[model samples]
Target: MSEEILINSTPNETRVAMVENGMLQEVLIERNRKSSIVGNIYIGRVEKILPGLQAAFVNIGQSRAAFMHVTDVCSQEKLIRLEGQQAATQSDVSLPPISKMIHEGQRIIVQVYKDAIGSKGARVTCKLSIPSRFLVLLPDEPNVQTLSIR
Candidate 1:
């Protein structure tokens, strides 16, 4: 099996193509006018907390505020602890309410997981993972490699 990456750049746009065994696998394009924020990180301020929906709206200096659910607000430590428990016991160890975790006018760092669509703003998560050429760094996480290099 053979794998290769092809990149093309123009004044206004740039494209990247991934190939495997002479077949195109994926293509990613970025334009100067409209750039993507799927992996970008930002220091957002908590705008509002909706206890009914168990989510919060955060302002990251964009036109609209980003939405973050309680599931995304939990720390990596809590997730790891939950993973160790049995499936039946998982429900018993539910996360605290979003309002209890965060309040209005508080600053938090988040990473964009989903882009905005229509009138909605982008979706963000607190469990950030930075990707580089060689590895994905998980900050404040346990020192263990969970993935095998090809």
Candidate 2:
């Protein structure tokens, strides 16, 4: 089996393709003007809280406010600490409400996991993870984890 990656870049657009045994496997295209923000991090302000939806709208300096859920705000694996605030006290049982976790006009760190659609805003999470060549770095996390590639 043979695999090859092809990348084509121009002024406005960039294209990437993966081929395996002369068969096209995947293709990705990105625009310079409208680039994807799937893995970007930002220090955003909490704009609004929707207790009914268990979500909050965060202003990440984008045109549209990003949406975040309670689960994202309180992750059992990673605890999210607000800017200049102490870490949240959580248990293994359950999570608290979004309103209790965050309030309006509060600054928090978030990472974009989904791009903005036509009407919906971008999806963000407080559980931030940065992947590198050999390990995944978790900010504000005390434990260090390494990647295993088998």
Candidate 3:
């Protein structure tokens, strides 16, 4: 099976639809004013750490701070590396508590994997990944497995 892409562009917005066997498989839209921030990198200051939620909110120069859970803290075996069109998943990996791992006022490098939806902020991960046309560059992977291809 082969896929085709149809793009509809205008001054204010652009819509891209992927068609497989003439059936719409996926649709992505980018508005001029509101573009997606997924896959974007940011150096942010940890504004607050919630031990109860096992998460931290970092001010990444966005309207709302991004959210990161303890599991997304980038462990050796639990890291997610997506190449091509692969989806991310989580596995069992033990690590220290979020409170002990990250402190308030600490600066961390994070990558936004999800965009802000409704009233919630974007979700980020410390395991930085840069996706290109065919590869997802895992710059933060352990030195041994530095670069990962799908």
Instruction: Choose the strongest candidate by TM-score.
Output: 1
**TM accuracy, model 2:** 0.69
Backbone N/Cα/C clashes per model: 0, 0, 0
lDDT of 1 by residue, 1-150 (tens): 999999999999999999999988778888898667899999999999999999999999999999999989976466557557544454566677899889999999999999888899999998889976557998856676766545
lDDT of 3 by residue, 1-150 (tens): 989999999999999999989877777888898678998989999999999999999999999999999988776454333222233433333456799888999999999999999889999999887766445678766454444434
* Poorest stretch of ten by lDDT in candidate 2: 78-87
| Candidate 1 residue pairs in backbone clash | none
Best by lDDT: 1
Q: How close is candidate 1 to the true structure, as a TM-score?
A: 0.73
CA lDDT, every prediction?
Answer: 0.87, 0.85, 0.81
Off by over 4 Å in 2: 1-7, 10-33, 78-92
- Candidate 2, residues 1-150, lDDT tens digits: the string is 999999999998999998999988777898898778999999999999999999999999999999999988856644433333344555533566788889999999999999999989999999888976457888757777666665
Order of all candidates by TM-score, from best down to worst? 1, 2, 3
